[model samples]
Target: MQDKPENLSREYILPDGRSVTVGDQLFRAPEALFAPREVEAQGPGVVGMVLRSLARCSSRIQLDILRNVVLSGGSTLFQGFKERLLKDLQAAIPSIAPVKIFSPENRILTAFRNMWITREDYYEVGEHKVKDI
Candidate 1:
């Protein structure tokens, strides 16, 4: 069987034999992450969030932070997500700042292993203080 072109709409028959059409939503849904305003969201998208977060950090560490960017979780699993993010960051960031994004094969698992706040520590420090951890 030949693969259907992504730009074209396709129909899938349900197990109960009803047919439903799938269209640009498949492409647009993922794209919303990069361009939230396209979907009527008020704030910046993923790339903007990354840039804003980096801006909030000390400038002395911004280069180090860019070098060690690691993308995890289900959203990062999308094909070309890392490349797209890197491309967008490079375009937005100064030429002197290098951009690197890593997507490990077991990203979700790796993220869980590396990032955590103990319940006891959170309770002791309170929510606001724990956020900096």
Candidate 2:
């Protein structure tokens, strides 16, 4: 996060010809994912969410899921977000399973396509096809 370029700053101008320089604003939103307490709000952070999800899955698949974690959404694009998430998850998850986090080249598009899959892309059930559902 500290490696951000110097010129990467957000600025606001006041009515009296004064300017307000905003630094690190880009890093703030994603910070909530890791340190929700610092942001001061309800609910668990991203690591907590992942742990909760892992807890619900079968023990056999838990390690596999951790090893192949895929993060979706625009917030995942933040610098070092994936690495930080992996580090936190690794520390929190029990066992010595390796943790890997992957963000798709275009996560939003991938999510949209997954939600809107074509009929031919899905398998058929006992008496009905995917399109029938």
Candidate 3:
């Protein structure tokens, strides 16, 4: 988890009027990225949720109902993570269709990069050169 870039991206103007670069901000993870506070997902803790989601899946269809999952931040580095998640999710959403976790690196940052780009293109207020930011 530490190896992953904090921002792996840069160029977002903060509310403080300073530009945040990818490399500098890559690891500056915010709380909201982990899970939404309004929704309680503390089932048996994180492991339990993994198990529950896995049980819902099956081998007969190899479905992928759940897709576009991006795992990042500190929690992604726990022991037996990838395999455990795959095994459990496979069980939980067996009939859901194709379940996929899109990245092994800074997935969250990648999304944020896109967001920054969109802000630049759409609002004309997000232009940022990593060096300048």
Candidate 4:
């Protein structure tokens, strides 16, 4: 018989046969919006929208660990992005600590950055407080 192809959908049936979905996850990152500037223009007010969506997400997620949300990738390159995103998420969801957006000065070497993080211990320690974290 030919090899069967696995379904690529986000939804799936678990061992007990109940269907599970990753659920309606909403990203507060401006990049997720087509016209991100619109939200940015309004500033922290948009966090209300994002928080409402997140609250409705399926409870299957372990929220304790979920509080520390990280945003990587090219699209998060807006100026003052991390500060803005955190302010909004915090205002709307008081329980959610903050949103951390990682931005490298040189966007071209994201892959290299990932490799560097993996081998971070091999590199010499620096006085940078962020690096200490």
Candidate of highest lDDT: 1
| lDDT of each residue in 86-125, candidate 4, tens digit only | 7666555545444444455666455456445433653445
Q: What would the C-alpha RMSD of candidate 3 be, to one decimal place?
A: 12.1
What TM-score does each of the candidates earn? 0.68, 0.69, 0.34, 0.34
lDDT of 3 by residue, 47-80 (tens): 3554456567784432333454556655665434
Assess candidate 2 and give its TM-score to the true structure: 0.69
Candidate 2 lDDT by residue in tens digits, 51-133: 99999999999888988999888778888988899888878866578888888888756556645545465543433443454
Identify the runs in model 3 with alpha carbons over 4 angstroms from their true place: 1-42, 47-65, 107-133
Cα-based lDDT at residue 38, candidate 3? 25
**Candidate 4 Cα misplacement greater than 4 A, ranges:** 1-53, 60-62, 95-133
Better of 2 and 4 by TM-score: 2
Q: Is candidate 2 or 3 superior in lDDT?
A: 2
Clash pairs detected, candidate 1: none
Model 1, global lDDT: 0.84
Q: Relative to the true structure, how large is the alpha-carbon lDDT of every model?
A: 0.84, 0.79, 0.50, 0.52
Q: Rank by lDDT, highest first.
A: 1, 2, 4, 3
lDDT of 1 by residue, 20-114 (tens): 99887666777889999889987799899999999999989999999999987888886678888999999999999998887888886765774
> Which portions of model 2 show Cα errors greater than 4 Å?
1-21, 115-133
